[model samples]
Target: MKQFLRSGVVAATLAVAGVSGAGVALAETMNVTIVAGHPPVFRWVKHASQTFIPAVNKALEGSGTTIEWSEQYGGSLAKVGEELEAVEEGLAEIGLVSSLFDPAKLAPQNVTYFTPFVVSDSTLVSEWMDKLQSSNADMKAAWEANGLEYLGGAIGIDDYLLMTNFPVKSIADLEGRKIGAPGPAVNWLKGTGAVGVSGNLTTYYNEIKTGVYDGVIVFASAALPGKLHEVAPYITKVGFGAQYAGGFAANKDWFDGLDPAVQQALRDAAEADRIAYHADLDASVSKFLEIMTSQGATVTEVDEGFRAQWAAGMDNVAKVWAEKLDDAGVNGSAVLKDYMDTMRAAGAQPVRNWDQE
Candidate 1:
C-alpha cells in the first residue's frame, strides 16, 4: 500500500495534545517519495535534488507541518516515461514526469516539439509552458486525467543540433541517410528525404559508434555529457528550438489530502526548480559547444537561408499531430493554436508559423 503520513508517537502526541503556547494541534508529518527517471547528471534532475527539495523544506519551516522526503532518481524507482503511472498508482507521491516519452497520454505537453524552430531560449519556453500548464484547461486535464497534479517545473530542452559523421549543407545531403530522432521529433525529418529512426540520448552514442545510425538529433546540454561529439564529430546547429520535455507532477490523491500550506510549498518549490534548472541549462549550452569544439568536434551553425529551407522542406507534421489528437478527443488543435499564439505574444519569432499553416 502507499505510505502517506507516518505519524509516529511524537506526531500522535503533538496532534492529540495541544501545544502549551499555541494550544493548537500540529499537522501530521508527511512522507513524500520523489522520483525521476533521469539521473542527477542532467540539470533538471540535479535541480530537483538541490533546489526543489531545499525550497520545500524551507517553505514549510514554520507551517506546523514537516515532511520526510525520499528521492528515487535515475530509473531507480521508475524508468523514463513511467513516472506518471508510478505516481498515479501510488508507487510514488511525486516525480519528474517526462511528457516527451509519454507522447500518447501527454500529447498536449509536446506542443513545442511538434512546432519546432519557434524559440531557442530555454527560459522562455519554460516560463510559457509553466503558464500554459497552470492556466490551460487542456494542459491541466492531461495531468489530472492521469491522476496527477502539474507542479510546474518544466524541463526545457535547448536548441536541437544534428550530430553526424557527415556534414549537411542542404536538405539534399540528407537523402537516404538514417538519422536518429527522439519521440515526436522524428516527424521533423518528414519531406527532407532522411530516414528518421526513433532513438534517444541513452543509445545515441553507441548507436552512432556501432553504425546503428549515422547521427542523432540532440541538444547540447545532453550531447556534452554523453560525449556524442566523439562519435559524431560533425555537429550542425539546426536550431530545432527549445522543447518542453516535461515537468514535476504529483499524485492528485496524495496532493489533495495534503494541507493547503504543504500543497503551496510544493508548487513554490517547483517554480524554484524551474528557475534554477533553466539558468543552469542556459549557461551550459554555449560552454558545451565550446568544449565540444575544443575536443575536436566541428560545430557549425546553419545559415538563415538553410534554416528556412529546412523548415520549409518539412511537412506540416504539427497539423497532422494536432488533428490526430483532436480526433482522439484531446483538443489538439486548440493546444497547437494556444501554444503558437502564446509564444508569438511573448516575442518569439518562429521560422514557420505551424498553426497558421
Candidate 2:
C-alpha cells in the first residue's frame, strides 16, 4: 500500500486512484489501542475489528491520517469487571466498557435492564440509548465523571433469555433453584422462586458445570457462542428483553488530545460500529437459537400469560433503581420516564409500565 505513494512527505502530491491531492500530504498514522473484557467471539468485539476499524480507516482515507489500531480484546488488557478502570487510566485509549459491570459509575445507562418487556429489537434499544446519550445531559455527565466519553452508542446485546439444564415449563419450574445473572440483571430474578447468583459470561459455564448455579439468564448472541446450551440445554424464552448493556468508549484525556479530524473519525467510526454491531446482532439471535436447538438445546417459548406472570413475579426493581440513583441526584426517574415514553411513542407496548407505577 505504501508503494502507491511517491513519497511520505506532507505536501500535495500526484493523485492516486482513490486518494486525493490533500490526502497526499497527510501520511501520518496514529495508533489507537482498543480493548474489551470479552473476546472477539461476541458480535460487538467482532464488529469492532470488522466494522469500526475499517470505517475509521476508510473515513480518514483521503486526509492521509490513518489509525493503526492496537486492539486488545478477550480480557488481555483488562478483566471482565476491570474494563472501565482500564479505559479510565488510559491503559487503552478506547474500549468496549461494559456498563453492566460498572453499574455504580454508569447506573443511568442500565435503564433497559430495569425496565424489561419493552422492545425486543436489539437495534431499536441501541438507538434509544444512543439518542439518550446525546439528548440527556445527565447521561453524558455520568461518563464524564468517570474520565471517559460515552461515544453516543452501544454494542447492543440481543434480547435476554433463560437458559438452564432443567426444563422450565412455567415459573414454578425454577422454584428454589439458583439462577446466574450478570450485574444488575440479577434483579430480574427478584420475587421469583429462584435465587439469583451474580455471574458474568466468562464464568457462567464453569459455575453451572461446577453446580455453583442451576442456570443463567443470558443473551443468545453470547449464550450460543459460549456453548452454555451444551451444559444447560433447556432454554426458556422468558423474554427477559434486549438491553444496551455496554458500548465503545474513549479515555477523555487521550481522546481530547487527538487531532480534530482524528477525533471526528473516531466518533464517526463509533456510529458505524453501533449500526453494524446491532444489525449483525439482530440477525444473529434467531440463527443462534436455531443452532442451539439443532445442537440438542431445548428452546421453549413462554406464552403471553406466562411472560406476564414472570414479569409480575419480579420485584419492581426499576422503581427501586430509580429512587436509589435519584437520591444520588442522578435524575434516574427522569431518564426512566424519557426512555419508556420514547419507546411508547415509537409504537412499543411495554408489558409493564416501569416508570409510571
TM-score to native of every candidate shown: 0.94, 0.91
Cα lDDT computed for each candidate against the true fold: 0.88, 0.83
What is the C-alpha lDDT profile of model 2 across 110-138, one tens digit per residue?
88888988878888888878888868877
Worst 10 residues of 1 by lDDT: 7-16
Prediction 1 global C-alpha lDDT: 0.88
Clashing pairs in 2: none
* Per-residue alpha-carbon lDDT of candidate 1 for residues 1-357, written as tens digits (9 for 90 to 100): 243543332334443365453565555567778998878887788898899999999999977777788999988999888888899888888899999999988989989889989999889999999999968789989988888889888999999999998988778989989999999999999888989998878788899999988899999999999899999999999888999999999888778877788899999999999998888988889999999999999988888998899899888989999999889999999999999999999999999999997
**Worst 10-residue stretch by lDDT in candidate 2?**
1-10
- Spell out the clash pairs found in candidate 1: none
